[model samples]
Target: MNASSDGSTTLFVLLGRIADRTLDDATRREAVLVEATLRDSIRAKALDVPDIAQAARAARERGVTVHLLDDGGLGPYETAVADEIRGAIVGHLRCATSGSITVRILPAGRPTLAAVVVQSGDHTERYEFPAPTGEQAHTLFHGLRRGVGRSHS
Candidate 1:
């Protein structure tokens, strides 16, 4: 999460709950197959892309402050953890999004799969973007990692 100069905070939150479940040989293989199928569906547009816009609409109706950040040119792997580790994150402008994803791997002749669940919320989402130099980016990376370590505890 990052706070804007205007004193509102925009947080990007990821919530995941991992579970332990026992599956027999056949069942475990099936799970992997299913994940690959779903991934293909989304990629082919057989499944609709994610609908973040709907959440924005609901926030507007309820009179809750909402800010959307669309930082382009950054790949998913990088952007996924970028803002969360930035120095500018602060305040009640806490915006949060939660989700779960499952990935399974099976033996030969079987399949591998993954599933994800997502939820997003905001008290008052304050989006922020400050051009950080290379040194600043390095600092942000370490800071974010430190924050993540604390949360796990």
Candidate 2:
């Protein structure tokens, strides 16, 4: 569905959920095709092309915090997008959760970026990203290191 142009900033959140019996294989494939067609149509009619870095910078300037989880092995464009996202995030979390799913970020020693562990019920998966620079690490881990302040008695 298209977003309403009501002066508010639009955030397009896309979550690719695992296919299930309810959706079936064919239905899932058709859904993907339909989304691609819509995206192509929008791109064709758009006056200005979207830039990831510029968008991320705009969001940051508006005091909006961003968080990113890169699953690695991205194409050139996707890698650029990930870099922009990384630049926008104010802080990173060691762990984040959504319902039954939990994402845990772990240090991958030298060279490699941190590894991410995704746990859902009995299933678990892991992925790694390129190592962050010292400054980037500080920016990313600030929230992870900062615990909730003590309550006043």
Best by TM-score: 1
Considering summed lDDT, which 10 consecutive residues are worst modelled in model 2?
144-153
Off by over 4 Å in 1: 1-62, 65-73, 76-127, 140-153
Tell me the RMSD of model 2 versus the true structure: 16.5
> What's the TM-score of every candidate structure?
0.23, 0.22
Residues 47-153, candidate 1, lDDT per residue (tens digit)? 11122223322333344333332222222224433333222222111232332111111122221111111234422222223333446544544543221222110
Question: Pairs clashing in candidate 1?
Answer: 9-93, 35-113, 85-144
In order, the Cα lDDT scores of the candidates are 0.27, 0.32
- The alpha-carbon deviation from the true structure for residue 98 of candidate 1, after best TM-score superposition, in angstroms, is 22
Give the alpha carbon lDDT tens digit for every residue of 1-153 in model 2.
132232122212222333323556755554554453344234322211233223323433343332223333222323443343333221222232321211122333444443334344565544434445656643433322222111111
Residue 36 lDDT, candidate 2, scale 0-100: 35
Q: Let me know the TM-score candidate 2 reaches against the reference structure.
A: 0.22
